[model samples]
Target chain A: MARTRLTPEREGELYAAVLDLLREVGYDALTMDAVAARTRSSKATLYRQWGSKPALVVTALRHNKPVSLAEIDTGSLRGDFHAVLQRTDDCQMEKDSALMRGLSHAVHESPELHQALRELLIEPEMTGLDELLRRAVDRGELRPDNPALKYIPHMMIGAIAARQLVEDRAVDQAFLIDYVDSVVLPALGV
Target chain B: MARTRLTPEREGELYAAVLDLLREVGYDALTMDAVAARTRSSKATLYRQWGSKPALVVTALRHNKPVSLAEIDTGSLRGDFHAVLQRTDDCQMEKDSALMRGLSHAVHESPELHQALRELLIEPEMTGLDELLRRAVDRGELRPDNPALKYIPHMMIGAIAARQLVEDRAVDQAFLIDYVDSVVLPALGV
Candidate 1:
């Protein structure tokens, strides 16, 4: 329904604006009024289009993902992983990480937002990632029952979340690439 | 210093109160006013003891750790890892995880909180973890030049942080032990 209401370029612009506002004002402080004013749209239009702030924010995040992991089959799992890092630049990754850190807290308090995030952003990526890993197993890279398989999502998310807590740095391309090459690959015996 | 102002028991009571408030209301909404009310201390005394809310909260988290990872030396890395998990009950671990999740977002907005968390909670744990890993390497459990060594913190923290995001569950001891047994240990070639 929303897709039909706006042109593709206009929808892209609206999503970008939503994310920019989210970065400037956190989820708790963010309001529909601010989103409308920033995008020069009316509150009614925003409500009609997104239904709610949580859904809007989650949809924007889904729209902004640099690459869908499902589309990444580079013939090698390592190559696929590297391809993910290459799709987004360091600055974008830092912004995305910051946005995610902000969202991580909000999700705890609001089940609706959590549900939207899982449906619109997290689950889709996870599905794509599942396929990526399954292919690795299919290629004899990792045993099907490799216990590490279940924990890959945790390791990937943690790599970003802990960087700020541990080293006080953003998860850049180099650090992530190194993590994949060293920690993830070695753990998987790839 | 704050240490001299109160007995250890009283100081711990105050820190426990601080953490309770932090979990109930996130860092942004938590205030010295609420803290003083909860602990039956004056606002002036609260400031006198901890200097600021961020400092006080970070100190509380440090005080609440179930076990200091640095003190763990169970003759092997596996033993030490398991030892780290045994010190805390699952309920407490879930609480700490929630508390940490609350603080994770707060640290993004407040440099003071971020600095205090790193200094009080993160750096100390990291120092202990570094020694633990070094001991493992010394015992020929891993190559000193092993690339995975650098990312162990990432993996460890990631496991906890990612659990909620990926699987929507708390990090229980059973799951954590298995993670260490399967993912972390295997990654290190242990």
Candidate 2:
């Protein structure tokens, strides 16, 4: 069956199941058959709806996001950055960090998965982030050619990904807000 | 059967084999039996020598590093940061990035692996980094209590890890050097 056939409630359940399976087994080990078994759906139905494992997995990941970065406009870069964090529940960051790490390796091995993830997930988030920076630049808050501009994603990702690795700490909102104020904002001369 | 009894050349080869197995498979899927088979050594010797899978893997990971961060004192934080990269061959950075990404996920699951990796691998790197930062602070090049002091590792790690994920680009020594100049120094007010 098509994805639209499912009610919103059914759709939410399926997406949650897919993400949980991904966190447990990773992309290489995850199978449409396993997804089917977990969701009590048929493999053909999944394949029919999403076209491939990568598409299905990426769609589920997208659905998990609580807010879109593109929609945020708080009139200041600091406000936008903090607002982005405000939208994401504090508890979700740790699990999301773990999930991204789990996929980081898998992304290296599968071009389709990488493409799907970027196109569906990372690209939009990046575009939204770029827009936020653009607005800041428009307001004369940042230089147009700051080399650090390109590295915002890297810095943010590093903060989220490296926190657990280096310090054995969960990435709570408090840490991220501080990170933005002390590290990110200063580096950008904001 | 002890690792001490092996010739230095043989020990290096065994360590190389262990690292190769780790890269091809991840920590959880990797086995002592696989390491033994790959290296043409007996599993008993492996256990007697390294004690466990996590220990053997961590030991091999340590052996692959070309420089010890603690041994480097370039007399300045920037010089030492660049020196650390100088010691690591540029060609190896991409592979090391992938290996770390691979391990990042597994590190979340296995406490033994986490302990061994932090104790054997990450801790020394942090210490060396800390020494470098201390030298910087002592020289009055940076503020003693700068919040960004703790984030150097996270920033550097992010630059390497997120390059491929975000930009689909390989991180070379040149890229790292530029990162040090652009993002890192400015953040530190250096």
Candidate 3:
């Protein structure tokens, strides 16, 4: 007797294995053979599901990303930013966070991956943050026109990512909050 | 004999060859054996000059990084920002610019190299830009209590680098200038 069902849970497991491979071997070094071995799936299965490594990688990242922004009713722009940063802080602390290292490596090498990453990983979060800022602008918690607003997401998330990519150290959440309040808020003239 | 005595220019040529080897092989793959073979120099000579790959790579970067920042005498803060962005535009156009790729890779891989890259390559430019901004603050071109000042350099450079790193496209100078004028200057209340 054998478990013959290809369940959704099995798909999720395979996708996670792809992420692990992407992180361990990097973009250039990642191979289907390795993914098959790691996932305990046949190479035929990977090929049947995803045509190539790029497709598999893109699919993995799409699944790996958070489905949507947290619905935060923190009542202030600063509070919203804090909530968002805290969520991101938790994600970065995960040991198997391919979102930071592996997928980023693929982005560097492939334009298609980069575009997919921005669309899947960056855009939805930014759109939500933008909506939050819009509400703040209406409420007078923030200036209507903040230049730093344009770069805040990049600075907060991208700065942490950039530092992680460089130092391979855990990001300091307190320092990030201070940065938001002292540097980002004041810059926005909040 | 084709040549017996090596000129100073020949020494510089040998160093350039070592750098070319670095680009081809990357830091970890680069070796004194490869450098000596490529440069047609004795292994003893490379060992006598630069003891290790890091030293050689650092030397090459120091020698190669073109005017990280030039003093801009633009009396207005807007003028200085515009000027700096223009220079950044030019630097971003070079395809074979090892300084960009190599330093980026080095910074990501090694902390010691990151510190050296920051100190040697980035700090000088930041210092000059800071001095220029300090002068602007002194002249009342910027607000005294502006916390955005800290984020400005990171934001400006990060936008350019992030766009390039993710998008694989050249940063538009006009768009950058507009971004500064419309978003940054207005946010600064200048």
Best by DockQ: 1
Q: Compared with the true structure, what per-residue lDDT tens digits does model 1 show for residues A1-190?
A: 3658788899899999999988887888889999888889999988888899999999999889867898888999899999988999999998998798778888988989988888888888889988998898888877888788888888888889878777888889999998999888877878
Better of 2 and 3 by lDDT: 2
Tell me the deviation in Å of residue B44 in model 1.
4.2
* Residue A138 alpha-carbon offset, candidate 3, angstroms: 5.4
Native-to-model Cα distance after best TM-score fit, residue A187 in candidate 1, in Å: 1.2
In Å, residue B123's CA in model 3 sits off its true spot by 3.4
**Candidate 2 vs 3: which has more TM-score:** 2
- State the C-alpha lDDT per candidate: 0.87, 0.86, 0.65
Chain A TM value for model 2: 0.93
**DockQ-better candidate, 1 vs 2:** 1
Tens-digit per-residue lDDT, A76-179, candidate 2: 99999999988887778877876787788789889999999999999999889889999999999999999788888888888887788788888999999998
**After superposition, candidate 3 runs with Cα above 4 Å error:** A1-12, A65-67, A94-99, A133-153, A161-169, A183-190, B1-25, B32-51, B68-70, B88-99, B142-146, B165-168, B179-190
The TM-scores of chain A alone, one per candidate, are 0.95, 0.93, 0.74
Tell how far residue A116 is off in model 3, in angstroms. 3.2
lDDT of 3 at B144: 70
Model number with the top TM-score: 1
Write down the TM-score of every candidate. 0.94, 0.91, 0.75
Better of 1 and 2 by TM-score: 1
Q: Report fnat in order of the candidates.
A: 0.86, 0.62, 0.19
- Lowest summed lDDT window (length 10), candidate 3 chain B: B90-99
Candidate 1 chain B lDDT trough over 10 residues, lowest sum: B1-10
Q: Across residues B31-79, which tens digit of lDDT does each residue of candidate 1 receive?
A: 9999999999999988887888888998898899867888899989899
